[model samples]
Target: MSSAEVVLDLVRSRPPTLGEGRLLCIDGPAGSGKTTLASQVASAGGDAVVVHMDDLYEGWGGLAEVGAQLGTLLLPLAVGSSGSYRRWDWRLDGWAETVTIAPSSLLVLEGVGSGVSLFAALTTVLAWVEVPPELRLERGVARDGPGVAEHWAQWTHDEQAVFVRERTRERADVVLDGRVP
Candidate 1:
C-alpha cells in the first residue's frame, strides 16, 4: 500500500483528537516533500481540507511565530467551530485575505511547523518527511529560484531549532522518506 493509504488507515484506527475532526500534520524541513504527501493524503481522504503552512507564515522569518498563527487557525476547530486566519502575502510582505476553515472529518496541516508541540494532543497523526539537507536546499532553490537561497538558508536554521526542541521526528507517528517518488 502507498504511504498515504497507511496514514489514512492510521487516522481511521484512532479516535478524533481535534474535537469532531481528525488532524493530520505533515511537517518536516523545507522541500522535504511534506506538501506532496499532504496532497496525496487529501486526495485519498475524499473530505479532507488542507491548510498550507506557507500561507500562515508572515514572511521569510515567520517560522518562529507560526505556532501563534496556528492557534488562531486551529483553536476554534478544536471546539467544533469554524476557524480563520489571515494569509501572508509573500510578494506584498504583509498579511493578506482571511481564510476560514469549517469543521471537517479530516484536516491536513502541511508545512515546516505543522507538527508543533502546542497542538500535539489535538493532532490525530503527525507525519515527518525526511530528506538530506543538501537535497532539500537544491529542491528549494529549484522551486523558489536562486534569489531566495539566503532565505532558504535561514529557514533551514530556524526549522531545525523547532524540530530539535519539539523532538518532532521522535514523536512522529510515521516518518516518510521524501526521496521516494
Candidate 2:
C-alpha cells in the first residue's frame, strides 16, 4: 500500500487523545509530503478539520512563535468548545482573516511546526514525514512557484531550530518516508 494509505489506516485505528475526536499532526520540512499526506488522511478521516501551518506562520521566520500559539487556539477545541485563530496571509503580508475551528471528529494540523513539543498533549498522533532535501526542495519550489522558492532555504533554517529544540521527529508516533513513489 502507498504511504498515505498506511497513514490512513493508522489514524483509523488510533483513538483520540482528547475529547471525542482525534487531533492529528503531520509535520516535516518544507517540500516533504506533510501537506499531501495530511490531505489524504483528512479525506479518509470523516469529519476531519485541517489547519495548515502555512496559514499560521507570520512569515519565513515565524516558526517558533507560531507554534507557541497553536495550542491556545486548539486546546479549547479538545473539549468540543469553539475556537478561532487569525491566519497569516502571505500575499497581504499581514494577519488577513480569522479561522474558526468547529468541533469535528478529527483535526489535522500540517506543516513544519505542527508537531512541536508544546502542543504534544493536544495531539492524538504526531506524524513526521521526510523526503531527501534535494527532492523536497524541488517539490516545494514547483508547487509554490519561484516567488516563494526564494525564501525556502531561510524557512528551512528557521524550522531546523524548532525541530531540534522540540525533538519533533524523535517524538513522532508515525514516521513516514516521503520519498517519491
Model 1 pairs whose backbones collide: none
* Tens-digit per-residue lDDT, 1-181, candidate 2: 8776776677669787657777888988888888888778777778888889888888777886856668657878877787677888887888887888887888888888888787778788888999889998889888989887778878888889888888989999878888743
* TM-scores, one per candidate: 0.97, 0.93
Best model per lDDT: 1
Error of 1 at 127 (Å): 0.4
Residue-wise C-alpha lDDT for candidate 1, range 131-152, written one tens digit per residue: 9989998889898899998787
Error of 2 at 168 (Å): 0.7
lDDT of 2: 0.81
- Each model's lDDT comes to 0.91, 0.81
Candidate 1, position 121, lDDT:
90
